[model samples]
Target chain A: MNTMEAMLASLPDQYRWAADLTSPSLRAATGALVCGMGGSGIAGDVAGDVAAGAPVFVRKGYGIPGWAERLRPLVVAVSYSGNTEETLSGVEAADRAGLAIAAVSSGGALSRLARDHGWPLVEVPGGLQPRAAFGYLTGAVMRILESAGLVGETGLVEAATVTDELLGADLDGPGRRLADDLAEGLAGRITLIVASGSAAAAAYRWKTQINENAKSPAFTTTIPETDHNEIVGWSTLGSAIRRTVGVVALRDTHEPPRVAARFEPTLGRLSEGASLVGEVWAQGEHPLARIASLCVIGDMVSLRLARNAAVDPVPVEAIEVLKRELGET
Target chain B: MNTMEAMLASLPDQYRWAADLTSPSLRAATGALVCGMGGSGIAGDVAGDVAAGAPVFVRKGYGIPGWAERLRPLVVAVSYSGNTEETLSGVEAADRAGLAIAAVSSGGALSRLARDHGWPLVEVPGGLQPRAAFGYLTGAVMRILESAGLVGETGLVEAATVTDELLGADLDGPGRRLADDLAEGLAGRITLIVASGSAAAAAYRWKTQINENAKSPAFTTTIPETDHNEIVGWSTLGSAIRRTVGVVALRDTHEPPRVAARFEPTLGRLSEGASLVGEVWAQGEHPLARIASLCVIGDMVSLRLARNAAVDPVPVEAIEVLKRELGET
Candidate 1:
């Protein structure tokens, strides 16, 4: 199997590890900041979404908000390879601020820093692209929150079971069918993913995955919010949108009726401006399962799109070039 | 002056009013959720950015998070015309939960509901489109917070003076000159606005204004964060970006050294793909002044682009039609 496929198959293992794991006592902190970058940061977004009853903020840049000091946040530094420069800077800043810290990574600079500082560190079974290993990173963050008593236990194990069922179902199943259908509509157009509630974070995941894996332009924004601003950008694009843009609405049971009501009006407004409008409904009993299922569907669509374009999805050559160039300078 | 121009000129008035306002004794509230829609909603974004000592959450849609009841946030409902249906739904939900509430609007259904419940209400100055009245809505929300003691005194009055200085300067001035330059290059291309720190909120404002006024496709995202994701989309587009996309990066001296470091690297990654990459610096010493300056610059750019496109900047036919359609159904 390819790396992405293998990493996805190992998701159940990550959930199993998280379910049995014990955590050290965290300090008296009212909130938590899950510090990461790129894929690691996206996982933090998912963790924050499912981290019930806790104020979880995802920090992606070196600049932490001023409120962090006053909240005395439990800082969760997450870097899959343990080498993300931004996360390391954040760890140091959090330490200087005297905030409690937790670290998650494979053995690398972050692990060394955590060891040096005696912070709680969880090691992932490494050797996958950071985005591909999102399940483990996300599960580790959520597990740490649960064990630390900051959040209630998540239905991660159940979610993993649903994922397994999805894997077995293949082309005729919900996940693959949804992927093939969306890839057809979104093949050559800029996709705008609209979503709300817990699924909002997952909407962003879909956008980034399309950009990286499908090699296309995509955008995502939460609703009721998008209703106010971006919906107007549609009219401004005029006729060009008919050929260049498509809409993907991510829906879940949790969307309030009033928010749902806005969708029909949005469709009327976007009718001629968009090439197509599509929907993806998250299917699961728990919010965690729903979120994971939606993410997996999007990942598959991105893969399907890559297949359509006859491009190898694994090679992120431009990113590699940027990294090499950045290192030299 | 037209409503938008009057409101823009009266930016000083809003600040002056906010500086003098005294808030009623709000209940012991720790954090706040500022609920708003469209133009009214962007105000909440600004309030959250500068509400130094407190965490402000901006809820755009009806599906408030499940944790909201547990958080018991001091809910601030903002809708400039006081008639936004979604904001009213949110207000009702917040009230049902027995959360403390504050309402800001110009006599509409929301004002009536706020009065009936004995909750705090701030009346916006009447007679303007909700978007045009953003300055008044923004100031009222900030003033409400100050009055409630949720946040400390903002240098609002001082910031107004800077607006006066900007208004007095001619075409050779900071706002107009920057606008002319940007509109020149961004005349017929899709603009992607990139920003970080306090300037991030302003970036969204710029994007929306361009969409609504200039009638174009535009996007905004914060930095370091954007570096991790959207930068990949640049290369993925291959050469299409060279013909279709222009990037506008909003800069502020307040950005950290590490974040500032990424700009050069971003330009390098974008060099081959983008038609043009431009940077506009925040103009004043205070954070508020700097943010407002960037916004004014963007507002002017949108106007200039509208003139170039031979489109009237005021009418929003699609939005009006959508509102009428939603009301009927």
Candidate 2:
């Protein structure tokens, strides 16, 4: 097995490690502002979809939204390396605005800043790729939210249990099969992942996984919204160009009836012009479980695609070069 | 000139028509929630970037966010035809939650709803593509904000004037040249539009324009965020796949210093593997003008590319079919 395969296999353990972790001092707030970018940032997306009672806003950019300054929502700053520049900027902005903050990172500038500012910090293990550290990051986020009284404890435990049970079962069969199916038509064709509601989060995860792990181009357009513009293009695509594209629909059992209704017709229209690789259904009852299952499948498919293409999925050398050139390294 | 060309040429008039209009009775609010889908939704994006005093939240999906229901921000519902399902759902949600709304549309279900509910309404001219009515939609939004005492009148007038002056000075030169350059290399390659800060709105505009007008696949990744993930993929792209992609950097003068700093190295890293079709700078001193300039240029580029490809830009048969299939028409 390759490095990514090992990392994927370790997901259950990673979740177990932080599953029961909690912070007593974290304060409850009306809403949450999660600050992180790329891998660490995705934790916010997952949390936003799963969390109950309070709304969570994910900030993938440099700072908190201007209105959040006055609203003073709890800021959850996540950076696996504890040194991501955008997350650091967001934390600083939150601090300057006097918003309460909880930091999640291994050990870097973020942890140091948290220590200096006396903010609550959840430290994960170091040395793994940031994306590989997703389980830990999300575990830390959910625990923080729980400690702060934002979400109920039952859902969190069920979600963790569901993820563990589903992923722990022999990982090779389904994922490898899906990857083979995808890789067969993915070459020389762009992939479009269609989804709606909370499932949109998984669609994005699929697209990014394909881009980073498989080293291919992928795009996502959500439903009802896509019905307005993107559907037009998909409907009118010429045969040659249409044949050069593939579609992956992420379906959720929990979607609003209206949202679900659009999917079939949308997929049918798209299939007329492009190839429909297949559909991936959301698994488990809890929101977190459903998101996790789809994300894991996508992650495995990306690794398999990388293996098939004869490329290593372990290193993101390009990101390292850009960071070094920017003098961040 | 084709229908799209004539519509593109009328942008100046669209802005001029709504320049002096303002509603006096609209109530003031802490922030604004602009809801719409497709072309109409983009007005919210542009306004969110340009509006002053209160921050604007653009909701592209159905319904208002749960938090917004309590926060009670001013809701601006925009649909060129006033019949878009998502926008209608958003307006209905806002209404049920007792949130104030101002509607922008030519004539359709939205106009009727607004009248029945006695909500404020701005009627834009009918018979043009929703994307083609961008100037009018934005103008209506600015006027609503002005009347609600959310933003100042001076900035609104200045924005309209800037859009008019720049777009009126013969639309043939810069945009045509850029389109010729882009179309030369865009045939078989996918286009990636890169942007940062508020200019990210313009970048998305460029992507959708290329998708709807040129009927091609295009993707957008914002700066700072891209530095963390996408840069890695672009940097490690294999030669054959690398040659099949093109990049367009949308540069803005208003980007934060740190955001501006990352553009060069990021572009440098991407250009190594992908063809950099060149950069487009955001123009005009006002925020609205800058966004308008970039959008108009992209609009022209999309139309030109369609002409070169021998495809009509006006009909969105796919969307109409989906709507009819869904029984909305």
Candidate 3:
């Protein structure tokens, strides 16, 4: 358990390396598709947010659509073990269709296939479970996107540096005392995550973690998108809305000024009925670092939430049962 | 209200004509992608399921993935108004990449673009809301897929016939007893829909309808897939499982005999502490009809469930708020 904690602590740094290495490859691709199943696909969500010029599609299924055969797009098939059947099928389809392909895996059939096919391979260091390797997967995707010329390399580096600093600073540190303050506000209330632009992916991650970790119902919505639709739903909740807690992930960059301006007012309106907690994150010099930092923070928060809820942070029995029954083992 | 009901009743016949006319065009394309949003996208799901030889992908976003473009796949951009921004964007992306394109619409910007670009156009009849014109959309997709030569034509004819029989025999007829039976089993229970193969799409449709119409939390999982995962999650609930209801959709021809055999035993074990109901549907001679019939049945079941719950079937105030806040409207 101590070793696991140490590894978890070192994740942010290793992720930065992964992101830096893959950046060059992403800059060269004409177009890219990220194929994975379940949690692994979350990396694609992050990539989509920061990708420069190339269009990216996240494919999740057993077989590639026939149309996929014709496009011959650059492909990144991601499976933590390199053996997800759906992802394998995607890689096979991509190969059969003669598309440029890359593989991201710790070790599995996908890694073997990548070796055999001589496809570009980004090897994630082994040991950690797929979900725990979020930093590596996310960083690798950003690097790949960068290398393929789909996004700028500068933003990714800057983001990584900022992420490192944030993690190192630890708002829960003695002087800052942030965690206790935030926890006090969150106590006994449901957390609602609201974000805009690229931060939307992090917001979703936060929501899912709170649900699965804290075993509580949580919700997330993207700005601009939510500003248009969900704002009205808040009007109907009335008094019961007081039980809701709002977490707004504020990014200094990415969001348009008009959108950024709406954040305070939106929170202020909801604050009338719900408790509001704001966490502002500055984008790192590198987009990859910036995204990874948010993810790391969200993961920590979720773990802390789990501790507060008196539950184990790892091993979701419900999901495990489903996987076992599926003959995944 | 009576006139609206009359119009709704004429939906099946209108759909048949549209199916027959458009089927030939789809028979020759190599591979196909169906692009649409929300209600219209459901048609793509049915089309993809029934398609025989060639694979079909339902694209539901602003642009096609880079890899999809390289495949040079045939594209069917669907928008009821012929002007959905996302679908139009997909069409433009497909055009820029030089894919064979077709349009399914009721005289909107997409139709004009199709005409101007000289792409094959299947104009669905006008005067109905997109959701109300599901039959037309489903048929049009089937026709396009058939014309592209991605799927067999016979299935299309057979499915359409089944749709006609189902509408005439059970849902529209006075002597029909299926609705009352389903209503009795579904009342006061959290319904779960389960199915296999093409029927899975119908199951999903049922789940969504129940959610939107009944204003209740209902869930769905595909068979074989669920046999692997969700079956295990049932063990923890104990007696609370009795409040849950299972509805299995069985299709005669498509499901493998082995899979069909497992349905009863699986449901038997899972529902040991719960209520289980089975509905056997014999698919029509045409793939289009078979899908349409199931869709119609699912919609009616959902509507009936909503009525039983004493909720309005059409209006979704929460979703409305979401849309308004997202600025989707």
lDDT of 2 by residue, B1-329 (tens): 88888888888778777886656368777788899888999988888877733668788887888777656789999999988888899998898988999999999999999889899999999999999998889888888877877677524455555555544555565556775676766665567889986787888888778778777667788898887767655544466656666898888888888889899988887777678887878777777778887777778778877887788988877777788888885
- What lDDT tens digits, residue by residue, belong to model 2 across residues A53-117? 36677888887877787567799999999888888889988888889999999999999999999
lDDT of 1 by residue, B1-329 (tens): 33455456666667677666666556656778888877888888888877755777887766355557866788999988787877887888888888889999889888998889888888877877676665677778877777666677665776677666665533334566667889999877778888885687788889888878776778876777776666666565555446666888899878877777777777666655666557888766766667777777787788788888877777777777777766722
Worst 10 residues of 3 chain A by lDDT: A170-179
Clashing pairs in 2: none
What lDDT tens digits, residue by residue, belong to model 3 across residues B165-202? 65564346421356556766776554566676557667
Question: What is the fraction of true interface contacts found in candidate 2?
Answer: 0.52
TM-score of each candidate's B chain against the true B chain: 0.92, 0.94, 0.86
DockQ of each: 0.51, 0.53, 0.12
Give the Cα-based TM-score of candidate 3 against the true structure.
Answer: 0.71
Q: TM-scores, in order shown?
A: 0.92, 0.94, 0.71
Cα-based lDDT for every prediction: 0.75, 0.78, 0.62
Give the least accurate 10-residue stretch of model 3 chain B, judged by summed lDDT.
B228-237
Candidate 2 regions exceeding 4 Å error are A173-176, A235-240, B153-170, B187-189, B235-240
Please give, for residues A187-276, the per-residue lDDT of candidate 3 as tens digits: 445566777655777776665555445444345655543432234334322344454344545464655564576576556544554567
The order by descending DockQ is 2, 1, 3
Error of 2 at A190 (Å): 3.0
